[model samples]
Target chain A: MLADGLRRALTLLLRGDPEVLGIAALSIRVALVATLLACLIGVPIGFAIGTTRFRGRRTALTVLNTMLAFPTVLVGLLVWLLLARSGPLGGLGLLYTWWAIVLAEIVLAAPIAAALTAAAVQGIDPRVRRTALTLGAPAWRVHWVVAREVRFALLSAVVVSFGRVLAEVGAAMIVGGNIRHQTRTLTTAVALATSQGDFSLAIALGLVLLALALTVNVLLHMLQGRGDAGAA
Target chain B: MLALRDVTHEYLGRVVADIPALDLPAGTTTALVGPNGSGKSTVLRLLAAVEAPSRGVLELHGRAVRSSAERLHARRAVTLVEQHPLLFDMTVAANLTDALRLRGARRVDGRQISEALELVGAGSLAARPARALSGGEAQRVAIARALLLAPQVLLLDEPLSAADRAAREALGNVLAALRDRGTVVCLSSHVLEEAYRWSSRIFTLVDGRLEGMTPENLFRVDLPPGTGSREVRVGPLRFSIVTDRSGPAIIAVPPEDILVSRTPLDSSALNQFPGRLTAISEDGHGRIRLAVDVGVELITRITPASLSRLELQVGTGVVLSFKAVAVRVF
Candidate 1:
């Protein structure tokens, strides 16, 4: 039975089974969109909090750090509460839709991006700003130079957020409702397949995830090599 | 001209710098000579207008640099090179190009960048990555980057602290040329003679207060073991000091503290050296300066009346005397 399942998994992937290909495409597109949104909302906040000094800055950072370990199911519940028919934001009727799942994934991963971005900016050499300023750079240019200095760390924030989004199952299952062809992601499909004892499909989706992770790693390695060439 | 008026900066609730009316006029090199924690760097930062003063105003050409608009002008007019300047993670030429762009250069010519590099003795380093250079090489590039700006006021915190001989010579000449072009160059150093070599005016900062330590007759002395005897030997002469420090130290004998006489003094001035005068010139302060080769060269300031009374001339025998307390040991 195990050998038969392995052959079926390879056939599903090699022959590009329509269902498996659709699941993988939806998973990547959702994760990329959610990661982009998270970065857009988080990078500026992180950079500002990391570089400037003000009251309540530490409190804000503490809150971000706390959310780095946030439970994804809890994030799904929050999204459900907001998007459900009886909830405050339910007027748009987005519950059980892919948008609801994207919202859940964003809540799950935005904190990771934010906290890591703040850490990245703070890890930079403190003299970068002073050096840029001394060279007659304007305030905006100084901030740009500082951001450029930690671009690799910033990219790490995005990559980690994307990873979190791709690997999350509870949020996708809770809000996405595991509907086939519309909101079912690779993670949710794997969960459904295993529960129904469809070992071939489960193994096929798992292999796809592993391949995706490997591709991300290879790309990250190449970018890091370029970054090191630009830095020490 | 850059001036600080009633400027006081506090760090960690402690008043670290307090200056009431300090002026850095263009067309000269002024050195702030001091040790660590003396607030020289703080003063330089304020002068650069990059760091705002806690109280009072930083003025440029009699206008206050308080608002952001004025601050932009102040920053463009004055620039600072820190004790350990930072270089961007890029090629030397790229760094200089960025600096030139920030300097408001309409056309950032590649030739201009390399010429600035050549001025600071880093011409060959243009193609090299900044992180690959040695400490001295990095510093030369940093100075070149700053010099390319051509600001009216240039502040440097220990600009030559990590420089080599060739780098030092190149920077000195460039700074001299900048001064000639009416740039106000302010540099800080712990070495008084090195300050004298680079600056025409020296302001000594001690515990965050400025005292004019005339950059003359300062010498580095070595005290061997059992140095508690308060005596140091340099070359062929034994000098008396009032410090408990043993090993390498610096001592300064103020020119005005030395008394010149024709005969040996029977009084309590402990250090008396007999030597012939080498040169006589104006002290620039309504007095005359006499250089006497007393084992080590000693500079003495005397009034014209006293000079005539002693009939001192070049190559005449004279006795220079100062008390042990006159020697400042650091």
Candidate 2:
């Protein structure tokens, strides 16, 4: 039975089955949007935390680090409450949609993005800032220069955040409702097919998900290698 | 003038730098000479406005550098090159251009960038990646970046620490040229000869205190009671100066007044000793500086012609003579 399921799964993936392809595309689209949004919101915060000295900086970093490991289901539950009927944001009517999944994924990924970014910025040599400032660069430009210096680390943050949201099932299931041709992602489809004992579809979607992650990481590695060589 | 008034810097409750007062004027170069951990870099940082003094005030052009607006204004005219320079992870040309842009240059002239690199003897490194440059190359690049801004005041912390011989000579020429351009320059070095050669005025820091700027060899000597004149002993050598000052006092001897000879001379000079020539090096100019071990080491400056005429080389035995009146007791 297992052998038959494996053969059927391979055939489905090779044939580019519409249902499987749609789920994979939706998964990538949602994760990409979420990761982009997280980067936009998190990079500056991380830069400020990593480069400046202020009151309560340690506490802020601790909070960010703790948020990095927040359970995705809890994030989904919390986001669900915010978008539920009679909830404060219910008037927007975004629940049970791809937008809702995007929101949950952002919440799941932003902290990781921020914490990793902070670590990367902190890893840069402190003299870089001094040199920039001595050259008459303002405070903001100093941070910007430092960010450019550690571009490789920022790329890693993007890759890690994207992978986190792509493989997340509990949040997308809770908030996205797995609507056919809309909210159903590779991870959710895998969950739904396995529960119904459709092992062939489940295995096919799982393989695609793994392949997507591998492709993204491999591309990033190539880019990072190029950057390293150019720097050298 | 750039001045520090009652400045004291403390790091985590431990005092690191304490300067009662200092005045640095324009169109002159001052050297801060001291050993490691002697708070030389701290003084440079304070002058650069990279850090604020924990106590007292730092003034630039008669305005306090404590406020953000004042500091911003001061930074436009002041630049510092750190001991271990960190260049941006970009091409050397880009580093120069970036600094120019930050200094509010409307157009980053490639000619100017190349000239600045040439000034530091790193013109060939313009296309190389900054991160790939060696320590000496990066140091030159950092100096070039600072020079591109044309700051009115340049502060350097061991600028020649990593420079090669050629780069060091190039930098010395650059500094001399800057003086002619009316830029006030201050640099710190642990090498006393380098400091004495490069700076018209030298401030010696011992345990974070400025020991005044006197163009003389300084030796801390103990003065014990004597029958006629006060006898001051430094190492195995003793000199009787015409002074009544008791206890420990600093003795300053003018380097130019000290004469070196192959034989002991019959003269009125009160101080004479037989010593070995430990080292001979050129003082930035054509003059040669000899490190003679006369009980305590004494630095004597002479022309290269005299050095050759005297036939002095390393380890050559010589007689050093100086008049007691030439010694300034403080």
Candidate 3:
């Protein structure tokens, strides 16, 4: 079975199927855009959660952690409801578009990024932050210093979220409609290929997904190790 | 000059820190000594700008600041070092470079790094990967980094707990030099002896309240051995000393003044005890720490040659004797 799958996957890649290549490219573009958006929104929230001493901080943290476990299909369903015709955001006409998948992925990954960033910042010695503030690290710099100290963790969060976005099928299919050569990602491609009994194509997409995940994990593992060493 | 006016803090509606008023003048090393949970670290945190006083104003050079941003501007002039030296995962040189980056002293800072390292006697380990360095070495690197920042005020929280005697002494000198350079240094420690030795003025914290103690107060003990009309007991294993009179007393010795012998010495040393040895450990130098059991537990430091000659072990019985004159009556 493995030999047959590999042979068929190799044959599809050599053939350079437009649908396959287009879907892979689109997946990369959407996941990157979504991850960047998540970071921009997530880092500040993480910083706020990290340094603030207030009521409901714990509640806010608990909610974010709970959201981390929210399944992909659930996110897809919620976004589908909001962007589908006759829904609240239906007038925007984002349904069945690339942006719909991007929007859904952003929502999916934001909480993961935010919660991990918060954890990383919180792991820093409280005294270190105080020292930075006292030593003239403008309050903004205090946030930055603490954030930078946890940069590796934040990177890992992004990578983990990226991995989730790359592998996410339910949301991309529902929101993007798996549009031919327009919105189909590797995951959507894999699902369509399997449904059509094109097992070779599906296996190829799976290989690419596994490679991407491994690359991210390796890079982040190196960075996190260095950061931990520095911390020691 | 650092001044706190009626600073008060509460957590979950319970007051955890309260100080009526205090001034930490420039260029003096003030040691804040207290037991655990006494708010020593909290006071350092407040001064470090990691915390805000719930009800009081903190004035630095007679300025008023409201937000953490403003406080950070003030903090640039004061640098705080935590009890555990938080070293970055990098080369020692890189960590020192970050400290320089903060002060905008890029060119001349490298030389200052070496100077700071030399002051702490860890100059030889400059190029070492920081993670591979020992606890004491890492602390010295941290001190070097803090000094490179050259803040007008320095706050240290139990910074020498991991250091050996030589390193501690070296770091003590470095701090003294900083004091001489006119840096207002506030240091906290759980050990009173360290505070007594290094601080010209001492502030003690008890149950979240701050109180000042004079230099003499640290040394003030009831019935130190040398003073006239005082009596105390020194037990090697068993607490079997029958004093001339019983009252508040202390068994004081110069530590180095203790003489160890295999046989009962005929010396006129007034205090002596015969005890089985409990443990023998060296402080990595010529000196050895001997825990001997006489009437009561006693610690004796003797030369390595004597230790080897006597062949001390956990069950070895030896005579622990010290001179009365060496004991100073409080």
- Candidate 2: where are CA atoms >4 Å away? A223-232, B104-106, B212-215, B218-330
DockQ list for all candidates: 0.56, 0.43, 0.29
Residue-level lDDT for A122 in candidate 3: 79
Is model 1 an incorrect, acceptable, medium or high docking prediction? medium
Q: Tens-digit lDDT track for model 1 on B1-330?
A: 789999888888888788887888767789998766788999998888878988989999988889887887788888898888878888889888878765566688788788888888889999998888887898888888887887888888987788889878987877877967888999999887779888888887766667565757777788665644367886799987777777776678989899999989997888988999999999788899999999999988999999999999999998989998888875
In angstroms, give how far residue B50 of model 3 lies from its true place.
3.2
Model 2 C-alpha lDDT per residue in residues B164-265, reported as the tens digit of each score: 897788888789779888999999987766787788889877667786544457776776765335557877888757676666656778678889999999
Which candidate, 1 or 3, has the higher TM-score? 1
Q: List the residue pairs that clash in candidate 2.
A: none
Give the poorly placed runs of model 3, Cα more than 4 Å off: A1-6, A85-88, A217-232, B11-16, B103-108, B190-193, B212-330
TM-score of each: 0.92, 0.80, 0.74
Q: Write the per-residue lDDT of candidate 3 for residues B1-330, one digit (tens) a residue.
A: 887778898878877778887678876888887766778887887776567788888778877556766776767777777777766556788777766565455475478778877887878888887778888787777777777777888888887788887668877787778977899888887676788687777887765678532222122223333424344433222222223433443333444666888888898776777778888888566688887766655667878888888887789889888665655332
